[model samples]
Target: MRVLLTGATGFVGRGLLERMSALVNLELIAAVRKPVSGFPENVTSHVIAGLEADTDWRKVLDGVEVVIHSAARVHVMHEQTSDPLAEFRKVNVDGTLSLARQAAAAGVRRFVFISSIKVNGEGTPVNVPYLADAQPAPADPYGISKIEAEKGLRALAAETGMEVVIIRPVLVYGPGVKANFLNMMRWLHKGVPLPFGAIHNRRSLVALDNLVDLIVTCIDHPAAANQTFLVSDGEDLSTTELLRRMGVALGKPARLLPVPSRLLEVGATILGKKALSQRLCGSLQVDISKTRELLNWTPPLSVDEALRKTAKHFLEQQSK
Candidate 1:
């Protein structure tokens, strides 16, 4: 099978490229914004300036069987654009649909889109997980754009004969992880006392390898065609538990204080950090029962095992 992967250097995409490149029966092509190195010798590279609605994909679509799209205008802490929704739509919705349409016309078999769990909602009630078919309640512009893109992809799949597999994954973490996950690791390594020991909120997180494995399965799985699946490590964790486990993996102690969740929320609101507090103290669980039953899939790596790998990588990077 010949596969074309976008966002080849991104966290998820890079992992996919590395894994898929090792398969003897598969040929890999990477679509990147600029020239990058260190890819396997057998892999091919195609440079496209940006993911705009008008970006030309005619040349790269030739002889491609599957396209795993991981590229997007990812959410940021402070967006500089005046119109965030429009900016997101240009790439997330419009650009995605444009690529799918062109792929369908070019006889591509499957297109796997990596979406976010934010499409369902920012957070769920304690124990009330969001299902794959849950009513969408996007809280921010990025979430809105993702839901819109999913709808457009579904319509396109109905119109064309191409199969579309959508996987909305929760927070993905592994080696090379950045942002909040990485920061948590740093704080834990430094023995900084965190006030999250009392946070009992359950949040689902997927390992990078697990998510990549699902994408590979969707490429040829008949049951996955035109299906929306939620992906996660079967186990859910509280913020306190997560930090403690991460500290253990790093061979350090997690110095967490038992602060009241309500107090934290109140302080955060006063400091204009309510959103950050919600992420730490809120629940965002996803139900992957459908994915397991339909595709007969299970995450290959355990949470503890994956965390150890991530910690090892972080330490290695720190040494260099």
Candidate 2:
């Protein structure tokens, strides 16, 4: 089947690209923001025009059987000015709708949307793991846009008689992982003391490979149409336990300083930090039973193995 993928230059998209490139008899249309270097011969690149306007998605959707949308505006820091929601709406909501409409017009078989767990909430408690049926309560503009996109896609599916599959992954980590997790790994590699030892928060995380596999299965799975699934590593870990395992994966000792949670919260507030402590110290757990029961899929790698692979990638990068 011919597939068109948006955000093919992103973190998860890159892995999807590598996997798709090795497959025979399948064509990949990669829509990217910039001109990428060293793209494979099998893949076709399309630069995204203005996201807000209704561009010609019909051209790219031609002969495309499936679409894996991995492009999004994900950021912790509000670097953009003059309304963040407008920025998020333009790309995540508007662009997604335009693409879906054209994909439907071209009779694409399936649309697989990769959304974040933040669409449920910023954090979850120990007893209540967020499920696919949970009411979406996005905590930030980025997440709000994702929720809107999901809603829009579902409505479009109803109107156009197209198949829609939504998979929400939590904290996906792997090789070439950028942003917060990468920084944390760097700090751990340097043996920096972290105050997360005292926090007993359980966060659900997904390995990149596992997430990619789920997406692949969702592309044409009979059970995935009009279904939303929460995908995770299955193995949940507390803050301290995660740090300890990360240290083990890195082959280094974790320097955890037991600071009071209140003190850390105060410090974070004084420094104008927004949601750092909550993200690090608070819990965001998910239930993946629906995903497992439907697809009979389990994460092939454990958290330690995943962390080790990520560390190895960084080490290899350091050597060069």
* Highest TM-score model number: 1
- Model 2: per-residue Cα lDDT over 213-262, one tens digit each: 88888877898899999998998888788888888888777899888767
TM-score to native of every candidate shown: 0.99, 0.96
Candidate 2 lowest-lDDT run of ten: 49-58
TM-score: model 2 vs. ground truth: 0.96
Tens digits of per-residue lDDT for model 1, 78-125: 889899999999999999999999999999999999999989999999
Extract clashing residue pairs from model 1.
none
Each prediction's total of clashing residue pairs, residues at least 3 apart in sequence or on different chains, is 0, 0
